[model samples]
Target: MYPQVLFQNRKPDRIATLEEYRKSGGYEAITESLKNRSHKDIQEILLESDLLGRGGAAFPAGRKIMTVSDDAPYPRYVICNADEMEPGTFKDRVLIHADPHMLIEGMLIAGYAARAEKGIIFIRPEYENAARILEREIGLAEEAGFLGENILGSDYSFSIDVHRSGGRYICGEVTAQLNALEGKRPNPKQPPPYPTEKGLWGKPTVTQNVETLCCMPHILRNGAQWFKDLALTEAGAGTKIYCVSGKVNRPGCYELPMGVKLSEIIEEHAGGMKNGAEFKACLPGGASTRFLSREHYHIPMDFNSLREAGHRLGTAAIMVFDEDTCMVAATLNLLEFFARESCGWCTPCREGVPYLKDLMWRIEHGQGEEKFLSMLRKQSKYLWISYCAFAPGAMSPVEGLLNDFEDEVMAHIRQKRCPFKGGE
Candidate 1:
């Protein structure tokens, strides 16, 4: 019942069909909004819902909508950012594969509210199945007159396009994705002309995360207060699809109320540690979030709680590590991914990430020194100087390793070998 809003159509056969979704009252919210509500009315409902972006930043959705210029130009655009390539993050992929129409309905609502003439689902290249599912569903919606010109017999018209990812992690960023969709090299753009003001051929645009958009129809269907009450935390609203990986026995996604305790997720939902291993630490939200040790296992896994605890709810993709796992190796693996994913657009990311990766490799291989650790510490402090969140995300694993496992780094130097190697 907790995740009913999202997992309502989880039955394999029933989930993928338009008829089932319609029978389940799918698209009713968008139909209602498009037919009865004005653009301002929809925005007001969103603002009152207190929904936050689920794409790592946790920014307010209503405020983002308000930033779009009321009279910018013709053909405003809305992009559903489905290019979810963050390491250990797969919640969006599951959502897309299981219930694509939910995303479509949500996009229609957002496009209508933003007064957008077009919408695009910029999905990841690796998600071939999801891309196929979306492509098929779009055709269905179009045939049903839910997507093409003149929807539900109204003047409001919106069209959606699917753009496959450029096989780069940078495209997950809002502006970077816009650049890629426009047939340019994917790289982060400087702010101030923040998409909503000047985007997609210099027209006003509103870009939203897939998961964020998926929540819209639910919010509109059940009042704003109902959405707010879905959270376990007082400060948060709605449910969060938490992705579990690493040391957990049952590593998969679970849509639970926000503010659910970390222990509940790890022990109850994830079925505790695998192979009887003890939990050492975890990257609470994919590779880019700070590590939380056993001390933080009791904290609520929500936006405000994680922030207050000096971490972020990044993608809500949790990567756990057991006692037997080597922190240096784990950190090195994440660094390798970030370093390779850098778009070479800025020196701080392109250059710094490789250097960080090399440092992690050396340390993981038992060739590290006090100087290497010092070099790592000094280099990581400046990784946040990049133009976008990429470099800063690259630095997150380093921060976690240093903060929670400095002793392991020192042990590599003191013992002249990786102590955790070969099962210690």
Candidate 2:
């Protein structure tokens, strides 16, 4: 039996109604915590669970909650970061669309644990259906005495709100998200004053990813020990919804236990490559992560395992590429996305990504030279070392392709055209 925390409904398209969700023990965790536990006690349970943020960074969620717990007078706030903007990452939307009430219940539990008085779910604009579903659910929760002013007749009170992002990738970053919520351009700011200290109109605020917040209700319902036992590895605890896409036979979101082998995920869960295609390389966690070849397919899918295998497990989105695919063309497609999504705040990202994209295009078209390749490599290095994570993420696919698929690049250079052309 799987933990009811993640897949309580179990149906692929089950959007839990407020009545159905409450029947399935949805608000029981929040009610129990609010009635019997203190803020410090809740924080202790979370810390014991060893729950790391499900967002790309994989930071400790309990530590983040503690940072904002002791400060503010009253009315501390929790923000659910639902801005699922990472390329090839679509699991958050799946969760929201399937069970928005689960997220609402989880956010309510987090607000209680953090002693926060207000909560906001910042969803991306492209997820219009998710936004709508959440909006309706929040309205129902509010009317039933679960959301507004006095929850379950306790002295503590919390309110929930929903805001839509303007379809920018940077809005997924914590600092930039704060800026967007404040009616400013969504650009990242210096982090000496982290969001825990001064966030959301200068109040104590803690922001968590949609998936991260949704895990809270389950952690509180089942003891921390039960949650820890769910992991397939030591470094990561709990199941993850891995989003597999691009050239795979089964391109969809999978709820697999952590530390499952990458090869198992591909060959079994994802049904391997499409057609008669042979695997060439894969970006283990979306376009932001580096490429891994057949040798790395045996690596476990946990964060630490992926890191040791030489890639960050970003959002657990694995984009597979077949042997017939051109690395140069694939990299160019990623660069195009990054360049278009850049906030243009810093020079390196604004100028550097487009420059790299242009070079890749020329190379794909057979107009590139050895000198152009060398220059592109140097520029990629510079961009990786630039201001924020945006540039570094943008540079990853290009650098990875060059390192793992150099022969493909050389094939493009020598053949004066794509070798995959005309199905040959």
Candidate 3:
């Protein structure tokens, strides 16, 4: 059975109010923490829980908090990374839209643990509705003494501010986010000085994903053991918001245990493939992840498990494709997105992606031979060794397609046309 932590009192079409949320025992954990637990105690609880970052890196969240707590003198800042810019990842937007108060409570608890005096929700510009809801909800929270000065009548005071990004994919990176918050272009910088030591105007800061922060209230209320038990596998813990897209009959978000089977999610949760289309393959995570064919659907969806299966559970955005889909065309489409979004910070990503896209175009159009395939394969190696995550991530779909759908690619070469030319 799916846990109620993620969708407890969910009204799919409407957002929950503070009053409604409080009635469902929403802020009780935070209220208890403010009244009873000290900053050190909260930090200890987090460490004991072993909660990893819900964002891409999967670093231990508790250790990060402790680093900020120990390094910063007195007032640190906590930033909730709400910039859900990854193309197929929209679970964060849904969570924030559904329950704004949950996020506020979680942020408050996190701020207390990190000894932070201020918090910021760095949201994407595309999430206009989410930002509006957060702003209004935050105002309500302040009036209710949950935010702003002297929160909950405790000596620990904290404030939260909502800021919108100028619209860029790299802005999702921590360093780029810090730069954007400081009124600069969103570009990543070299790091020996991590965010914990020097961040946000040279003050210590801790950044967490929107989903990561929202999980805090439940963690505090239910205890770390309960949270750990939520995992379907040893490597992962708690419920995850799985966003299903592409050719599924019902392409939407479903909250399930961390290691739920991909087949179960596709057939049961996503309502199976559309038009009774035969399942071909899936990008188990977002576009950045490697593709997994129908044979791999039995594998569990978790951080390390997915990696062991030769893919990354990146943002848990499962994009399914049916037999009718053209593998080469699909690979080209994803490469186009990566090429366009490249920040040009590194030479490989800036040039390699576009070049790879051109190679795919030539091959897809059947204007090439074995030489083109060889060149693309060699270019992928260079991309993998690039400066940042973008170049390597950008190569995933192409490499996966080449490895898993070599026959389809060869058909394009032989026929000089896309196999599914008329949408199969």
Candidate 4:
């Protein structure tokens, strides 16, 4: 309803065909960009747009593109990171199903902006159907000359392929994804040779999230100023693909202004809390981010605004919970997933996550020691020095429990039972 550029052609019950997308001026940007704009012009326009990466980190998309030097080696790669493994995150799957060509067109333009020749959509194994749709649509795109070998009669040529991952949460990490793509054991490689400098078989590769890449085509289609004006806040640009779930009546994807308030996203768009349930808290961004208590109910849901409030809009996967939900048990549940999915590559993440999970489990089951609280706090900070961000992210809910929901946690320890569970 709010100017759905991305979902403009989203058809209910079935994916939009190439004809529908084309009719709505889908591939028009790539065509116009290739014919008139130089690669530098593309770079400048993105910078002006102030588009940040939708993938957790919120890195500047323009700056990331600029990293690939114009003089960088040929046959560079631009990987569309479709490994949407974060708990409570599934916007990528919805976006892919709604319109596959949008992704293809976005990647074609991304490949051009990043000076890349090959584009790869590195998706997780669970998304097999989406992968097949992408493959089918890609074949259609090539047949229509939107991809492969002098696209649209321009000198630039690019090809895109969908690569199914072995299906691990670790594979979503940038360096680990590159390793997985190369058939190597997926381990987080410390940077020095950043992906843009050297990646994916020792070549300059630009890897971006599916949502991040999908933004490019639209940004290019609309002028930079127009893109900047789309956000509800001065700090944000364009619309955000929010994947809202849990406790909300309408738990699905919504394309809204980047800086829409968290309250409005819930009360207005998502049909408010389920069954008139009183809102207790929410993981404002997927499971990895800290919980947003009722104190910040009206907080602006944008990267900069969230950061200013000591929070993050990581993937904007808002997982809401009603007052009847138990915070301690909720945090414990998230911790278990993080511990189980840990790659076990580094000591902090390998051992630390499970160790923290055990402490939370004991507390929830009436075996908690007050000492464990201090230990949890200590370990959460200690894990930050891990090989990658996996440990810190995994420990976020733990940190949130200790910080925001300490009273609930203490209630469990003192009562020797989960407060939310049925009384004996």
Best by lDDT: 4
Model 4, residue pairs in steric clash: none
Q: What lDDT is reached at residue 282 by model 1?
A: 88
Q: What lDDT score goes with residue 7 in model 2? A: 63
**RMSD value for candidate 2:** 1.8
Single out the weakest 10-residue window by summed lDDT for candidate 3.
415-424
Error of 1 at 285 (Å): 1.2
RMSD to native for every prediction?
1.4, 1.8, 1.5, 1.4
Top candidate, metric TM-score: 4
* Reference-based TM-score, model 2: 0.96
Error of 3 at 20 (Å): 1.1
Rank list by lDDT: 4, 1, 3, 2
Clashing pairs in 3: none
Candidate 1 or 3, higher lDDT?
1
In model 1, state the lDDT of residue 394.
82
TM-score each candidate.
Answer: 0.97, 0.96, 0.96, 0.98
Candidate 2 lDDT over residue span 1-424, tens digit each: 3444576665665686888878877888888988899978888888888888888888888888888847566668899999988989998998887777789888887787788989999989999888888888888888988888888898988888889998899999898899999999989987778778788888888999888887888889888888888888888788888899988899998888788888888889898889958888888887788887878878889889988867888889999888777778888888889989888998888899999899888888878787877898899888965668988988888888888888888888888877777222
lDDT pick, better of 3 and 4: 4
Score candidate 3 by lDDT.
0.86
Tens digit per residue, CA lDDT, model 3, 1-424 = 6877867867968899999999989989878998999888888777777687777777778788888746566568899999988878898999998888998998998899988999999999989999999999999998998988787888888899999998888888899899999998777876869887789988888999988888888889988888888989987888888999999989998999889999999999999989998999988878888889988878999888988877888889898999899989889888888888888878878899999999888777767576778888999999977776777888999899889998888888888877788332
Clashing pairs in 2: none
